[model samples]
Target: MSETKQSGSPELQWVRILDLDELPEGRVQTVTAGTTSLAITHYQGKYTALDNRCPHQGGPLGEGSIENGWLRCPWHGWDFCPHTGKPPGGYDDGVPTFPVETREDGIYVGLEAKPPRIRTVSDVMVETMTQWGVTHVFGMVGHSNLGFADAMREAERAGKLTFIGIRHEGAAAFAASAYAKLTGRPAACFAIAGPGATNLLTGLWDAKVDRAPILALTGQVDTQVLGPGAFQEVDLATAFNGVAEWSQTVLPSSRHAELMSLALKNAMIKRDVAHLILPNEVQEMPAEGKPATTPEGRVTPMEITPPAASVEAMLKLLRTSKRPVIVVGHGARFHMAPIVQLAEQLNAPVVTTFKAKGQISDHHPLGCGVLGRSGTPIASWFMNESDLLLVFGASFSNHTGITPKKPIIQVDYDAMALGKFHKVAVPVWGEIGITANLIRNELGAIDTVDQRPEVRARWAIWREEKLRREKDDRGRGINSASVFAAMNRVIPENAVIAVDVGNNTYSFGRYFECTRQSVLMSGYLGSIGFGYPAAIGAHCAAPDRPTICVSGDGGFGQYLGELTTAVKYGMNITHVLLNNNELGKISKEQRADELEVWQTSLHNPSFARYAENCGALGVEVTEKARLDECLERALAHEGPALVEVRADALLV
Candidate 1:
């Protein structure tokens, strides 16, 4: 705040507004003195000041035209006296007036000392999000969410959070979902009202169905215009009804940080989408110095032991079966070592669902590769010969059919996921790692049959079949099998691979044998543009891990702009682009269903050249002979790189 001061008059507290020469005579302009905005008018060789806002809809009086000595509001044509801020009519209320004076160097406005900025609701909530370990946010900042974005900006400046501005809201959501999938923790996505908010649906559904925890922060129109259709307004809570496990709108009356606490807790405990909508005005409302919330005592330990009866049932099934096998899904990824120990105790073959493709190495003595539609003959043969299925954290999706007739003992952390589609002989609802240990403890040395020889025999048969097909190139382009063979040879043992949905993905699932790599995919949602964006998240989650992304011509085209983002961040991603110049999966489905494959073919640019234009290493592989050299170069590159392999669409 400042006070008016003149050379010949008593001095009061005064703050500089603008240089006297800056405002011409007979003109009015808006200026700021700390938090107070003023309309400084220069008329009659003197200066006067008034509040800049008009009472009529809060329009800027300074922007109004001075006609007939009256300042007319530009928004609605309301009038006020230019010097006195008095309306032309007998209106009781007008803009407030402030004292002003001229100094040698500048014009000064009279007020008290400038006040410190008030803490805001968004500030409290962003601190709470930080305390909950949500360090990364992916989204675009927009007008509706400017206040919330400002809070994030402050936190980012303070090094408490990192915000990645994205080209699309949908990509933000996918990146957040993939972050959660990779780290088993919550990351946030942000958007403005209407279309920006709605763009997050597909990725939200991806996290929801796959049981990944994610937070969505959306901006809404002012509460007053919510129902009357303000410019970008939409009922965000209603729009997110089924997708988010919990959703709420922030209000001035609400506990600001508590709302954020609940959103984070719900996402963490439920392992699903949690959302918060910040109304425009409410987001900027003063928090009055309220403290933030945290997860200090909010979360509980997740691991639990199975019931005694279920454990006994599992033991009995394991002891009696001549051929028992263990099957894990994406849900079991974090607890692989314990399950592998249990597999060794029973000499059982371990197979994975496609989503869990690289949980265990294919070279492991007991590892029988993936089991399902995108599976190998080794897994199918082992499953057919098994008498009991020791299922762990696997959802029996139709794509990965766990035979109903087999005697089964299913284990999972979520009670709802235990034999969700059908009944099992033993449904053990316990944490995966704990239950695996319990099974191993009870069956100390159960003289189980050694199935290692059979596993080796099956692997030989599958490998022989794969080799026979690898040479079946039709001369159109490189064969799918050959490309994957090159990948299996080039990618590191500890690489993280994100595969998109298409014929290329199917080939990856079928032919790319894992040594110790981890695979991430869209899984239940099976969205197309997931690979490249997910690779970004994976790189962020484990910066030291070699990250690889595989996508088809159609899938990569969807989020093609993300390549620049990879380059901007210098993410170490070796993107394997299999270009067949068509949506081969859809074409195959149409042909199999007795329909003409219409609109499935596509037009594509040279993705390798595109990557080069984006400042990344790019290699084009048209022949099988060039694949190894190209892949080696790409994987060894320091920053982001791409290997575009032209392939035969029909071979997949």
Candidate 2:
């Protein structure tokens, strides 16, 4: 019998693979030593360690059964001598064997030390991403994407970026979308080929319709097998057509860093999804000293000022109006400081679209709250009474209910967004902040109604109604009003709140009054499983701020596995889970449509206990009295926590 080199080779380090009698005779088991997977076989009183991969199709030999004194490959049925790591006499291809030693304590195998990483295409591209201010990545590392994932691992080690491994690719995309929505900066969502890449579609569409900047990196099969149908191959370019503003496949001869730079540029400039498909082989190609690029000279300043004619037309309408109201939307979120200043100057009431709920504090004197279906009566009243509507960065979506009857002066950075739905008195095209400042500068004095007293009175009426609803809860569960009331008290004023779809979202829109908290939601898409993952993203975007997730039972169940992710990363997030044990929103919709509410119910476990099982603080609130205490405890937890509120479905 031939044995591995008997003499010591200092380069190969010894690693224990198993203990005595661990593996039964004639059985093969898998083990790892120094990042190398090996098939440890014990047959005929001798143990041998061979490389785990089958030479034919890379099938795992360890998983194969020993039949007739030979190990049969599980995938292809190819046979090799179990003890000698050799195939049939006619075949010359044999599996590489590692030196195995049996000792009194355990069995050990020798492996070479891991080598230093060589710079690859993925490395240069990742470097460019960091240089362009891509600080966070949400992804799942899978077989096809290992090469790129390795590069990301190195970036994480160097502290250039943070990589969050999520339970699903959809969560990764939603997280990236939320991060960009909150920070106005692009964050990347990564996934492997085929199903993993396709899983990101819903969230990518969410980002696309809402005009949020997001970068999507997906793995592809080898370039050689791209045209024909290889395993896990999907034509990513055609698949990402409408969702991604820019999509490209990384090639061996391509300028890898430039592709990354362009992807980011398109995302930033268009406020849309940008995708890159990395072929497995191309990701590991030698960078060959190719330099990474940056946004320093590549990007132009984004402060676009309004045209002279448009500004004049806007001023003419503003100067003559007596009861002017300023409406803002999601696009206006980051530029609210100046917009609020302008609102204060005109003594105009400021209302936001549902997506822009927390752009301006509800406590501000001029802030009138959200508009449309998920809006405050205060906002509706003011908009109905206004003589002129000064809409800034707001798309005239039907959900927003921006009154077309009132003379409208709409301002937007995108020329296409201006007067998109209907003709307005003036559709001023300019960047929101610069335009609002210019309008403030150009208008010396403005005449408008002082709507503060009306705003205060409306808020008082709503609060009274909320208190009444909170008290009249049936014997089913605690009212959502009480839950949000507790949140208004316990949630940090400067927190970032990610809300999910369904009745919980409507309740949040109606009941949760923002002080300084930033609210994130699946706005245009209204996706249900967005809350917890978005909270994860918001935390990544602003780690210093308190992060919270508000979700209903049905919505929370969609991505409950992400709780482990939050726990693993020690994300300081307080999840307010409203558990009604049903898809309350769908039930309500069915009833509203005069149809029987079927298939809207859900089976749920003890979510609080589940959180605890996932290594997080868990508190369940069954009674109204316990609501405040439970929320306070969860909010005060040092790490990921869940407060499950057994909420009444009808109360929302």
| Top candidate (lDDT) | 2
The lDDT of each candidate is 0.89, 0.92
The predictions' CA RMSDs to the true structure, in order, are 4.5, 1.9
What TM-score does each of the candidates earn?
0.87, 0.96
Model 2, 255-312: lDDT tens digits are 8999999999999999999999999999998886799999988888999988899989
What are the clash counts of all predictions, listed in order?
Answer: 10, 0
Cα error of candidate 2 at position 638, Å: 1.9
Model 2: ten consecutive residues of lowest lDDT? 1-10
- Residue range 330-433, candidate 1, lDDT tens digits: 89999999999989888999999998998999999999999988988889888889989999888899998778989888999999988789889999989999
